[model samples]
Target: MTAPVFLVDAAALAAATVGGVVRLDGDEGQHAATVHRLTAGESITLTDGEGRGVHGEVVEVGKGWLDVRVHELVLEPEPALQLVLVQALAKGGRDEQAVEAAVELGVDTVIAWQADRSISRWRGDKAERGVRKWTNVVTSAMKQSRRLRRPTVEFAGSTTDLATRLRTVDAVLLLHEEAEVGIGAARFPQAGTVGVVVGPEGGISPEEVAALAHVGAQPVRLGPHVLRSSTAGPVGLTVLASRTRWTT
Candidate 1:
């Protein structure tokens, strides 16, 4: 069976190492200790969220925290392929679901785009709040998935903003239902970073699709059946990860 994983801040870990008792203090801590029902001398893995992990055994238990002794430290190499998901804002909880799944699937980054047809809109403070909420969701998912690295989330102003972000990566893939080209046929650059753009429920407008294509973003079709915005990002990430041998 896979070991249970928890995310520990650098300070909490330091305390855990010196025979110092540490409490799981926040909601996350409570979840780890109470929900998981971990006990003294039991082993659990802790991740620093920056490609660092430690195997630790619980030494002391508190109402909220667990005192643990670090047994082994493991450093994982960064993924060979860096995948960024530029997801168009979807209604209700769908966007949050997408972010959560993307993180679990090992997406390196997420970009929230206010697509022209999106029903949910984010502006000013709302945009910042939305980003924070998605960030928290990704963090939680990362911990649950036992990932060593946390995915970064960014908010985009316009398609122009997305285009600018695409420049930082090696290649950008635009997933459009109307696109004729299959993802498997497209030749992804060797040892390259990839960014994938997924549209909203209403889908990407032809003008926006053209705009992305103009910026050298290759359009790829997943399949005949259309997928929900929440589902597309994870599916695309998984396919991309496998195609590039990012994860074994």
Candidate 2:
């Protein structure tokens, strides 16, 4: 099995050097030491969740923390093509499901959309809480996938807000059942931000579709069958990643 990756603060990782010992503590440390039961001489990896990684071996284990002797520093280069997911809020935590899976699928950023037909609403403190919850989910998924970088979660907003926010994106492929074009045939820039917009349980409203289309979002179908709101974004991303990141 690949070495389990634990996240460390950027500053802590920056201070780490070859042959030096860096202590892992706090909740992450406790989990590593107790839950994983890492022992001396075992291999592990540490990252700052921003492309910086440290390869090391467990040298000591304490109550709630362990020490690792740094072996090497690794810095992952940023991808030339960035992938973003604009997921419409859905009932029964389906929105959260999309975000978690998209991150694992190599989505670079996530935006929550409050569409006209969305059953779940995020207003006042609920909006803030929702963003925080998404962030936590992204963190967990990043670790589970052993991703070197963490994807960011943006604040939840309305369809209009989403359209405005995506104006700068190079391509926004909005998943629609009635679209004439399939996502596989849709044209996108080779190296820029490409966004996938997934609608709510009720699907994207006509007005919402037009508003996003006015801002350059192309309505595209994933396949002949319509997928649930939670499944479309990740499946769309899989197609894009296959064309972009998965190939030689």
Candidate 3:
């Protein structure tokens, strides 16, 4: 089995060298020490969630912390092509589900979209809480997937705001049911960001689609049948990953 991963402080990990003892504390440490019951001489992996990973063996364990003696340090290279997921807010917890799945599928960044037809609104304190919730989801998914880097989660924004932000991306593919081309055939940038837009349960508005298209986002379909708001982004990401990340 692959070694379980725990997140560590980036600065501390960077300063650590082979044979150095790195401490794991706080929530992650508690889980590692008490929950996982990691004992001395057990193999483990620690990451700063920014591409650096430390492979080590547990040297000591306490009530809520464990120390690992580092043996190897790896810095994963950033993807030549980045995948960004723009997921519209949906009712229930579907949007959160999409974010989790997208992160596991190697999405580089996730932008929450507050679409015009969205039933669940991220208003006032709920807006801040929503972003925090997605951030937590991304962290958990990263560890669950054993990923070296944690994908970023952005605050929820309006359709207009999303369009304005996506204008700077190398390429954007808007997942629309009426789109003529499949995502497989869509053109992706050679070495830049590729944004994938997935609408809410009510779907993307025509005006919103036009707005994204005006910013150079190509309308594309995932498949012949429609998918749920929670399913679309991950499916699109999987297709992109197969053609890009997985191939390499």
lDDT of 1 by residue, 1-248 (tens): 56687777867655454334444556656777788888887887877678777777788777777766777777767877788899999998898898898888888888999989989999989999999988889888887888888888899878878777777878888998878898877657756588889999999989888888877899998988899999988888888877776644
Candidate 2, 1-248: lDDT as tens digits: 88899988788889999999888998889999999999999999999999999999999999999999999998977899999999988999888999999999999999988888989989999999989999999999998998999998886478778888999899999999999999999889889899999999998889988998999999999889989888999999999999999998
Judge candidate 3 at residue 211 and give its lDDT: 86
Model 1 local distance difference test score: 0.81
Q: Per-residue CA lDDT of candidate 3, range 79-121, in tens?
A: 9999999999898899999999998899999999999988988
Error of 2 at 214 (Å): 0.9
What is every candidate's alpha-carbon RMSD to the true fold? Answer: 2.4, 1.0, 1.0
Off by over 4 Å in 3: none
> Measured by C-alpha RMSD in angstroms, how accurate is candidate 3?
1.0
Q: Rate the local accuracy (lDDT) of all candidates.
A: 0.81, 0.92, 0.91
